[model samples]
Target: MFGSQPNGLSTDNKMLSFQMASDKVKGILQLKKYLEQFGYLNYKNSKNRTHENDDDFDESLESAIKTYQLNFHVNSTGVLDKKTLSKMAMPRCGVADIVNGTNCMRSGKKNHHHRHGSGSPFHTVSHYTFIPGNPRWPASQTHLTYSFLPRTRSDAINPVDKAFQTWQGNTHFRFTRVQDSSNSNIKIGFGRGDHGDGRRNAFDGPGGTIAHAFPPPDGRFHYDADEQWAVGATPNSFDLETVALHEIGHLLGLEHSEVEGYHVSLHLYWSH
Candidate 1:
C-alpha cells in the first residue's frame, strides 16, 4: 500500500505508499479511494472491481494511475509510490485531466508562434497549444467585455479582475468590466453543480475541482462556489487568481500544456 518516508514524516503522509509486496490492505484501499475521486479508476472501466468494492490493485487501476502521473508530470511508474500518493493529497483544481473530445470547436489552422528548441521531444520544453482547431476570439476586436454575474462574491471580484490583468499584461487582449449589460462577451460567475454550460464536466463540490472556463467564443468562466477560494495562497485554500489565470488561458484559446520532453517547434491551428 504505502511506505513510511525517512526523517519522521507523519503517519498520514506514509498512509498510501505502503509497499504492494507487503500488502498493506488498508493503505491500498485508501489509494483506490483517492484515485476514484479524481475520475481515474471508476466502476465501469476497472475489470475486477468498482470504487465501492475494489481491493486488489488490478491492471485497470494501474493504467489510470499512470495517466494521472503523466498528466501531473510525476514519474509514470504505474505504482502507488510515495511521490504519487503525496501529489494526490495536494489540493488542486477539479477540472478533469482528460476533457471530453467533443467539447471543443476546431478551425484546423496553425499559428506561427516562435519555436524554442529542436529535435528531441524529451529535451524540449512544452509550450501551451490551443484545442484542436485552435479556436480563438477575434484578434481584430482588441477590447473584450466581461462582467461578474449576480451572486458573485464582492471580495472575489478584485482577485478575478487581477486574474484578467495577468492575461492583459502578456497578451494583446484587453478586458473591461461592464454592469447591467447583457451584451458582454465574457460572463464570469460562481456556480455549484451544473451551471448550464451544456457539458458533462460539472463542478464536483468543494475539493475535486477549483474552476473551469470555456474556450473562445463561448467565454463562460465558472468557479466552484463550494470551494474555499482565496485571493491569495492560504493553507487549505486555493489561490483564486492563480486558478483564474489558468482558466482565462482557456478563454484565450490555450489548452493544457502537454508536450512531454523538449522540442523547438510552434504550431497553431484554427478557423475564423
Candidate 2:
C-alpha cells in the first residue's frame, strides 16, 4: 500500500504531506480507514471532499491523525510519521474496540419501564459501568467446553491450555478441553486465509491479523496458522497465550475498551 507518496511526502520528510495536494495515497487511505474504526476519523466528513484518488488526505484526516497520536501517547504530529506508522503496523485483533454503538454495556427490554423516574425505559443496566452491553458469560454456567482442531500443533496445546487457565483464574468461568469438536462450545484452531468460518472477516494470512473470536454463544476462536505462535514473547513470535487470553474474553462477551493508558482492552479486568 506504500507506493506513490502524497506530492511532498518522503521518508526524509518523515510525515505524510496533506492539504496542499488533493492526490490520494494508498497507505494514507488505509490509515484513515483503520483510524475511523476507533472513532478518530469521520467518513461523513470526507464524503463530500473531492480528491484525485480514493485514499485522499485532507484537513479532517489530519485532525483524526492528531487525535489518534494523542490517544496512543505518540507525538501529537498531524502528519503520518514513522513512529505513528509503526504503531499502526502492529498485528491486532479483528474484533472492534467499541461494540453495540455505545461505550458502556446495555441490557434489558428496549421499551419496558418499571416507572422509576424520568430515565429511559427498556434499559437493563449493569452494576459494572465499564463493560459495554454488560455482556458476559452466565455466572451460573461456570464450566465451558472447548476443543483444538487437528490443524493446531501439539506444541501449541500446552500454551492454549495455559491461556485457558489464565482466564479461569481471572474469571468465574471454567474451560475444559473436549475431544469431540462438534459437541464443544468453543472451537480452537489454526487456519490460513479463509478457513470457512462463514464470516467475511477471515484470517489475513500471517502478519496482518493474528487471530479473532466470536462472542458468547458462538465461541469460535481461530488463529492465523502462518504466525509464529509461541508461549513467550520472542522475536517474530507473537505470544499465543496473550492472543488466546484476549480471544477468550471475546468468547465471554467482552469487547475491547477504548479507554487510554492501557496496552490492551480494559475489559480484560472485568473479572476483578
Candidate 3:
C-alpha cells in the first residue's frame, strides 16, 4: 500500500518527516510491523526505554537497515531519512504475486541459448569468454555466477553455499565468494558508508527486494543491507538459506517462472 504526503512538501524532506512521524504516531504502522515481522526489532531493548517514538538503532538494527537499502537500489547511507521512508512506503511485489500467472513472472517467447561467441539473454555465460583472469572456456561452454551478501552468522554461509553447489551439480561452471574490500576483488560493506542501508527506501515493501546478483564472468551479487538474516524459524520468519538460493538462480539466468508449466509444454512440442 502507498501513502501520501501533505501539499507544498519537498520530496527529499518527506521521507525523513514520515519516518519521524511513523516512529511517533501509529498512522503508518505497516513499516514497523514489517520490521518486527522480520525480527529486526528487539523487544527486550525497548522494554526499559520509555521513548517509543525514537529509533534506538544498535549494531544489529543498523545492519538490518543497511541490508534492506542495498537490495532496493537506494543509497546505503544507513540513515532512515525521508527519501528512504517514502520508498519504503511504496507497494512491493508480493511472493504470491510473483508465483504463477502474475505480471511479474511473464517472459517473452524468445529462447536464450548459450552458444559459443553468440550473445544471448544469458549474460553470465556470454561474459565468461572475456573474463581476464578466468581460464579459457572450451570451444563451446556456458558458465554462471552466484553472488550475494554474506550472512552475519558464519554458520549460515556453509550450508547455504553447499545447497547452491548441490543445485548446480554437473553444470559446467565455477563459483567464488566475493570477499570484503580487503580481498581486492569486490568488497561488500555491511552497514557503513556506501554499504549501509539507512536510506528511507530500504525494506519498504515485502522486505524491499531482499538481494540480487549479476550473471557470471561479471560475478557480482549484492544483498539488502537492512535485514536480520536468521538460520531457522524465528518470530520474524526470515529464511536466509531459501532467499540466497532464489537470488542465486537469478544470477544463473533463470527468471521467475509462471507455475512451471507454460514453458514445459513449449519445450516438449519443440523437442521434435
lDDT of 3 by residue, 1-272 (tens): 11122211123442354322223323323444444433343445654233323444434444445544553445776666665565554322112212122222333332333433233222332111111122233435444333334544464567467645744552465555555433422222233223433343233323444444333323334445454456655544345555555444434444433333222111111111
* Residue-pair clash count for candidate 2: 5
Clashes of each: 25, 5, 23
Cand. 1 Cα-lDDT: 0.59
The positional error of residue 184 in candidate 1, measured at the CA in angstroms, is 1.7
Query: Which scores better on TM-score, 1 or 3?
Result: 1
Model 2 spans > 4 angstroms off: 1-15, 19-23, 36-53, 63-67, 75-78, 100-131, 198-200, 258-272
Cα lDDT tens digits for candidate 1, 1-272: 01111211123654555334323345556566556644566655334554345456666667777877775667887867777665665544443444333222122222334433343221222245566566788779879999889989888789889878756755688889888546888889899887786445576566544577777898888888877766675766666666676677778877655433311011111111
- Model 1 CA lDDT for position 193: 82
| TM-score (C-alpha, index-matched) for candidate 2 | 0.70
Q: Give me the overall lDDT of model 3.
A: 0.38
lDDT at residue 230 of model 2 (Cα atoms): 68
Best-first order by lDDT: 2, 1, 3
Using all chains and alpha carbons, the TM-scores for the candidates as numbered come to 0.65, 0.70, 0.38
